[model samples]
Target: MMNNKISVREVLVEDAKALLQIIPIIDKETEFTLRGEGEFRLSLHEEESFIRNILAEPRSVMFVASCNDNIVGSLGFRGNNLTRYKHTGEFGMGILKQYWGQGIGTMLIEHLLSWSEAHDIRKINLKVVETNIRAIKLYERFGFEIEGVQKNEVKIADQYYNLLSMGKFI
Candidate 1:
């Protein structure tokens, strides 16, 4: 059954401790992600500082998904700072390996779309490893279209993979 109890909300500064523990785990769990296993080496204090800074940014938003009070996923948007690119935002997300295919990613994307539109973001962009068909399909379902592909953009364990650049105009 789907975990209807999963709760998603904007991340808070106080959530840093729990986030620090989970971020690296989630990063290592997904080969489709930019970071490979054990590459996320941020310390607790650094994570807290980063979280505080992100929370303070008016153009940025980060949300976490939790089930039974345990965090399982994260989605974030980083808006371009230059006035020329203010209307564009970049997205990044990851869910625990165990939670894959459970619809949590869809929930996060839906929330992101609603939030981005409300914030006056005109374009939302994301890069997906070409081999990650699941993620590509998910983005396509949410109206994101592939704009181009960067050949050999991602190298994992000495093997390179293309990266698909996608964007959604709201």
Candidate 2:
């Protein structure tokens, strides 16, 4: 059982250390994400700089979910700087394994959709490993549709997994 309430909010520079700490843990817990165990190696200063950059970018935003002020999950949207593609962006998210099935991902997506609409974002897209049915279902519940598939896109554990491209129009 969870010991505290879960909340989602815009990420802050102060979250750099906690964010950095949780990311590799989540990576080790799941294969759905692109990164694997021991693959995330961002220094504290670099993480702080990254949060600052995201905060300064008009077309990009990042949010983190906390349980009792402990960062447990994160969601981020990366929009294009080019005027022609500024209305569209791709998002990626991750949550700690223990928090799964507790509506944390849903909370993050709701927050992202609300923020995207206010920021004039017309479309959002994401790519997921084909074997990740749980994530695919979550995205589909939020109105994302599979637009295409990239065969043999990611090779993990000596096996290749297809990547599904999904998008939603706001």
Candidate 3:
């Protein structure tokens, strides 16, 4: 349920091409959200490979927000593993330029939390840009607490930006 327009559903393997159309939108967000981060902007081929990888992983999931069957946004959750931390998960979500400021992101997070709980995942974590105050606030609303900070963690173009680690427990 989002803006009474968008619908969230499991991402399909064939959706790789459709998802590619949203690349420019994600790129713009990454410019700010992942600035000073040595992040790789995925090419179509690379993204397709990633889609395949996600599809193959049983403990990972991908969801997309669609309106009239057109992809508008996406979110993903992957189970974390470090032997002692097998009950944890990491999540990420993104909305298209036109869809930002809507309630989609929060709704997506809600869905993910519910999904995680049902799957027996006890904790969920996310790394956000320190400058992304709006996002940080939203996550707080959902009960995520600031766990710590990784200062100058991302080297974007020429600068290193700080990252805030946030987590929520079920």
Candidate 1, pairs of clashing residues: none
Q: How do the residues 20-134 of candidate 2 rate in per-residue lDDT, one tens digit apiece?
A: 8999999999988889899899999999999999999998999999988788999999988788998999999999998899899999999999999999999999999999999
The lDDT of each candidate is 0.88, 0.94, 0.78
Give one digit per residue, the lDDT tens place, for model 3 in 61-127: 7888876678888888888657788788888777777777777787788778777777778889999
Q: Residue 108's C-alpha lDDT in candidate 3?
A: 85
Quote model 3's TM-score: 0.84
Backbone clashes in model 3, listed as residue pairs: 36-154, 36-155, 36-156, 37-155, 37-156
Top candidate on TM-score is 2
Tens-place lDDT digits, model 1, residues 24-76: 88877778877887888888889888888888888889999988788889998
Best by lDDT: 2
Q: Relative to the unseen true structure, what is the C-alpha lDDT of residue 16 in candidate 3, on a scale of 0 to 100?
A: 83
What 10-residue stretch in candidate 3 is worst by lDDT?
A: 31-40
lDDT of 3 at 71: 89
